[model samples]
Target: MIIDVLKNIARFLILSLLQVLVISHVPLGSHFVLLPYVLFILMLPFETPKIIVLFASFVLGLTMDAFYDTGGMHAAACVLMGFSRTHILKLISPREGYDNVMKPTVQYMGKTWFSTYALILIFIHHFVFFYLEVFGFSEFFSTLLRALGSTLATFVFIYIVQFLFYRNDKISI
Candidate 1:
C-alpha cells in the first residue's frame, strides 16, 4: 500500500516536471499541444477513490498552471478529466469487468484498449483545455481542430511513454 503511494508520488513529480520543463517548451507549433501529464491521471490504479483522483488531478493542473501562468484553465480541464475518468473506464470496461489490481496501461490493457481509452480521455482534456484557454466559441471550428490535433499528439506520446516504461516484455536492446 505504501509502495503504491510512493510510486504514484514519484510518477506525479516526474510527469509534472516533464510537462513544465520539457514538453511545454517543445514548440509543437500553434495547433498541437502535448500534455503527457494527463497520463498521470489516466494511469492510476483502477481501485483509487474518486475524490483522491480528483484531488490529484487538481493539484497536477495547478502545478502546470503555476508554470504556464494560465490562471485556472489547466485546473478546470484536469478536474473535468478526473471527473470523467471512471465513467470512461466503465464505458470501455470488459464484460468480465476489471481486475482489482489492473492499471490503465498499454502493457496490461493492450494497445487497442489503451489507445481507445487514452484517446477519449485525452480528447476530453484537450477540448476542455483549449476551449477554456480561448474562453469562447468565437472560432469554434478552429478550437475543435486544435483540440483534435493536440489530442492526437498527446495520445501518441502518452502511449509511447506507457509502452516504454510499463511494458512487461523485456526488450533486447
Candidate 2:
C-alpha cells in the first residue's frame, strides 16, 4: 500500500512537470499545447476513484492556469474531462474483460480504441478550453477552426511521444 502511494505520488509530480514543460514550450498555433496533460490523466490506473481523479485533474489545470494566467479555464476543462472519464471508459471498454491491473495504453486497449478515446477527450478538453477562453460564439467559425487545429496538433504530438517512449506488454484485459 505504501509503495503504491509513493509510486502514484511520483507519477503525479513527474506528470505535472511534463505538463508544465509542454504547456510552456510547445505551440499549437497561438496556444500552448495542453494534450500532454490529458495523457497524464489518462495514464492513471483504472482503479483510481472518480473523486480523486477529479481533484487531480483540477490541480493539474490550476497549475497550468497559474503559468498561463488564465484564471480557471484549464481547471474547468480538466474537471469536465475528469467528470466524463468514467463514461468514456465505459464506452470503450475491452471486449473480453478488464482486470484491476489494466492501464490505459495503446497496447492494452489497441490503437483504434486508444485513438478514439484520446480523440474524444482531447476534443472535449480543447473545445471547452478554447471556447471559454474566447468567451463567445460570435466568431464561431474561427473559434472552431482554432479548436480543431489545436486539438489535432496536440493529439499528434502526444501520440508520437507515447509511441516513441512507451513499450507495451500484453496482459489479459
**Structural RMSD, model 1:** 2.7
Backbone clash pairs for candidate 1 read: none
lDDT of 2 at 118: 84
Ten contiguous residues with the weakest lDDT in model 1: 164-173
Predicted candidate 1 versus true structure: per-residue lDDT over 1-173, tens digit per residue: 78888989999999989998899899998788888899899988898899999999999999999999999999999999999998998899988899866677777777789888889988999999999999999999999999999999999898788768876643332
Best model number under lDDT: 1
Shift in Å, residue 21, candidate 2: 3.4
Task: Candidate 1: count the clashes.
Answer: 0
Clashes of each: 0, 1
Q: Which segments of model 1 are wrong by more than 4 Å?
A: 169-173
Native-referenced Cα lDDT, model 1: 0.89
TM-score of 2: 0.87
Residue lDDT tens for model 2, 3-46 = 75676677667767877775556654574344566777777678
TM-score of each: 0.94, 0.87
Q: List the RMSD of every prediction in angstroms.
A: 2.7, 2.3
Q: How accurate is candidate 2 locally (lDDT)?
A: 0.78
